[model samples]
Target: MASDVRFSDSRVGVSTPLDSLREVLGVPDLDTALLTHALTHRSYAYENGNIPNNERLEFLGDSVLGVVVTAALFRTHPDLPEGQLAKLRAAVVSAKALAEVAIELQLGQHLLLGRGEETTGGRRKASILSDTVEAIIGAIYLQFGIERASEVVHRVFDPFIARAAEMGAGLDWKTSLQEIAADHGLGVPRYVLEGTGPDHDKTFTAEVHLGGERLVVVGAGAL
Candidate 1:
């Protein structure tokens, strides 16, 4: 899609019309009107006044996604204990994974955003994309049912699941990070400035640390 597909204010659209999304998602009968609502973000809704955001659908989709992910985990890991199942669930629903799926579906291009969000680049944000993805799943479940939502989820999550299985080990990065931070009695790690450059060009250095030991990562870009 073209970059010009900016959100109405700057949040809801940056892609071609959602007519194509239904085709990509394989839900031929999925109502386009609902999709308009699905794509509408609260920020955009506030500006329009006539339309509402996808929040309610997002709320519904959150639970639907949980159910779909849990059910898949249960069916796939019949032998694994609860701990393992929880790990798989986390892996499937992680912000990273959902954002990846949203990208795969090209969903980000269709988001509706308020001008503030658009000017600030809300389109590529993981939190917004992930929440919108979940909301879409919920909207599907409501319009159809678990069967449709599950089918779509399976199709959407297939690559992620296959990759995880190939890794041949349980995913525990987030979990391990928590324990390691706690063991060192670190309340939380934060970023502190570490450099400078010209007005249009700059750099950032962030440190994730526990006690006196810190891991610093530096990145450079333009505002």
Candidate 2:
């Protein structure tokens, strides 16, 4: 909402690395400066003499995400109760959910983190990744207003919302699996996660076990 904000390259151009990211986000005209601000972590700012960071944008984006997701759930599920809607919203907007979306966008590679954070594996941290997603959303809102922001939000988040809806009263996939196991008297489901490859391009394999038997194994590429 602040019109006076400025960045070295205020207008994003084809020469910038962010041009590809802008294309992925379907917001080709987004200000490069704003996008850079959104990607800047506090540690990066602190290391650089307290320059601006993404915290403010993250805050604005969190609210925008909540509002957009809530409206979508309300309109899309007119027959659902308030409690169910709340659960669906929670599932779609959770930190883990947002982090998954961030991973899909390959956002970590583009983040601006301090050297210390980089050494400590900050890129894979769910909090930072999720916060960055919010910051980007905030940047979009600031640049284009809620209408355009809503369009982007829907594009990225609608599938997750629909998936959550299909989970019925179980909310997320984990909870749905748990409920199903409980109903079948299969005991609790246990998850084992293993990561392979280098820090920058690790692949994760998750195995779900029930009653001491491995039920499924799923793999995901680097975040």
Candidate 3:
């Protein structure tokens, strides 16, 4: 889809309209009006009096995204300390991360921007895209249920989780492994560890599953 639009007309033809988002979201019958509202920026709403913008929806979606990511992180990394889990959550929910997801979905193309915003390149702005993505999530949650919203959240964020793991970003190898699993649309990696011999002279073996291909890693440590 085309990423840039001209501001010559007040209403630019979005190359990837709300209907095109259906395939990306995996929701075939999304409500057009709700999605349209999600795409409307405050500037645009002000210009077109009586039309609502996505601020409220963005507020709700921010909460919805938090719950979904928090739950997934909690469930997936049972062995991870609270600090690590929180860090991972923060990374995934960061505006930069959401903006990347919006870019991947070509959501910028679908945004409804005011003439000034359009001329100023608001379509390519990270904040606008991220907020719009959140608004869309809110719209989905209001129309569907938490279950569907969660699914969309995970689906959109899986690849990002993988990238996070690859970067390490202060996370341990085991945490990275679990994130990798989640990235591949798989359940969290399950780790099995065993120790043998005396505490002072013990050998430990650890095994874990990672990735959609279900790659397994085994390692041994002795003290």
Candidate 4:
């Protein structure tokens, strides 16, 4: 891997942005162009005589991200139904989630924005952050294969996965209602669940009662 491309060798500049990113990502032997391309936005690319941007890499990374998240979800949540698993996956791979990860990585600091974008606060934009995160993933995958890329993804998103798992559980109304009730010092919520109609077209209703509370919140769903 070290010999695969031209190493920086201090040719560009000392204490450069790439050096900072290399140290942050712990990939000392990373290909310069790969990382540079990952950091380059379309505006910067156009400004620099139409040099390549990260969009292509972002596209590739989207699929890589999906595979990584899907495999992790499948392994970790084997008991969850397919629908629930999909929801969890969607939450984790969402643009907002990726942008949050990018913020944690401080990737915005390394972006190569054009003058106009820089003036417009492009560094803090969620779209740019999320797209760059995916591009970085693509670059890592191309350089070190999926195993290393998966490691990077996991390292960057471990906290996010934990939060997403909690959010996924909250999708169950009973669980959320119970948690909310407990938070409000209302003890556990009691629910009287009932259903109507045939199996093919059934409507279910849940009447929830909190401790010492006269108000009842009714939730309904169809199966």
Candidate 5:
């Protein structure tokens, strides 16, 4: 599979190569055109003469992802209530979680972006990365069918689902912390957030306070 062929975005005169991406996705036989479309962000499409974007595919993929995740959760955690199951699904399918998966797959490098988006660090944006993941799923489903798409979804998301199940209420740290604090008669947990740097690239610092005493301060850079 010589996957290194260039698909040109004519308006921007940009060429996106999919060889590395195909290997990373573990879907070598995916149709090049479909895969290219999956990687095409709206910014890129708009800049390149308003060509089709990945939004439709993202929509389709969202449904596919939901079904697979829901079915798996239903089957595996037969004892869980509906509320817990919904929470588990939300945790796994959230933008943050999907973005983490995209980062692991190095999907950022494969995104097709416009000049503005590329310069503004759109590749690392959680929203774009997550949508792209879904678009890829849509492409896989269209090309290969539901069974193969489910395999890919499981490969990327099963660990997240399992961790969410294990964590249960802990998946929502703020709520979990508040509950623990309430039980311990510590009043309520207060969170103070501070953001720094440019809007396109920012670093966030969070402080957790209990009983008017600051307990933890942690900083994380935005992706």
Candidate 6:
């Protein structure tokens, strides 16, 4: 846990972005180039000499992180309701959480930014840090696989997740829906079961009605 991470290319055997990620995360087998793609911001790429951005890895990382956090939440809190578990997972995987992890890993210093992004203080931006960190996690999983990525993520988020577990249930989708209805100056929403699918594979369709008015949007899910 070094306090101040330097961006210089002087470290031994740390010539590439994956090397930088490995050095920073204390995990080997890191594809330095992929990690480079992870930390690379679109702005930096645009400003730099035709360097690629991190959007693709960011997308993959977002899903990977969601799965990781959801699985962790499910395993850690068996007694908690699903809604609460989802909320807890949401909090755990929030941008803020990712940004904190980025800071802990000293990721900003290692970013290969373009001169414009660097000048614009992109490294310190929370959005950039959060996205970059997720991208890195995605890249790490792709290179090192699920076992290593899970180990690394758990190693990073253990304490926070533990604290959240101690704190208890967090997700409440129904409540959120209710809140939306309430805020929209609508009366209690009436959920009408639109249709039921076949016996083998049942599907539930729900539509919310506001003030005796049917909602335009309908939701479908496996029962």
Best by TM-score: 2
Spell out the clash pairs found in candidate 4.
Answer: none
Pick the winner on lDDT between candidates 1 and 5.
5
lDDT, model 4: 0.81
Q: Estimate, for each residue in 1-223, the C-alpha lDDT of model 1 and write its tens digit.
A: 4421122332234343665787777775666556667778888888888466788888888788778877877877788667656777777788889999998888878998999889988999898899889878867787778899889888898776656543324575445556556766875555465556775666655445555656644455444
**Candidate 5's residue-wise lDDT over 1-223, tens digit each?**
6532234334244334776676667776677778889999989999989888888889989999999999998998898768678878888898998999999999999899999999999999999999999999988998788999998999888888788775466567677677667878889887778898999988888788897585755656676
What would the per-residue lDDT of candidate 4 be over residues 1-223, giving only the tens digit for each residue?
A: 2332222445344455577667666665667778888889999989999878899889989989989988988888888767678778878888888898888778888899999999999999999999999998888888788998898888887676767777676557565566567668888877688999998999999787778855587889996
The residue pairs found clashing in candidate 6 are: 18-32, 83-171, 84-171, 87-171
- Rank list by lDDT: 2, 5, 4, 3, 6, 1
**Every model's TM-score:** 0.67, 0.73, 0.67, 0.70, 0.70, 0.65
* Off by more than 4 A, model 3: 1-16, 165-223
Q: Rank the candidates by TM-score, best first.
A: 2, 4, 5, 1, 3, 6
Compute the lDDT for candidate 2. 0.87
Which pairs of residues clash in candidate 3, taking residues 3 or more apart in a chain or in different chains?
none
Span of 10 residues, lowest total lDDT, candidate 3: 3-12
Q: Which residue runs does candidate 2 get wrong by more than 4 Å?
A: 1-4, 7-14, 171-223
Candidate 6 Cα outliers beyond 4 Å, as residue runs: 1-21, 165-223
Per-candidate RMSD, Å:
10.8, 9.2, 13.6, 10.6, 9.7, 13.8
Task: Name the better of 2 and 4 by lDDT.
Answer: 2
Candidate 1: pairs in clash: 5-14, 11-112, 11-113, 12-111, 12-112, 12-113, 13-111, 61-138
**Candidate 5 root-mean-square deviation in Å:** 9.7
lDDT of 4 at 196: 98
- Model 1, residue 99: distance off in Å is 0.5
Worst 10 residues of 4 by lDDT: 1-10
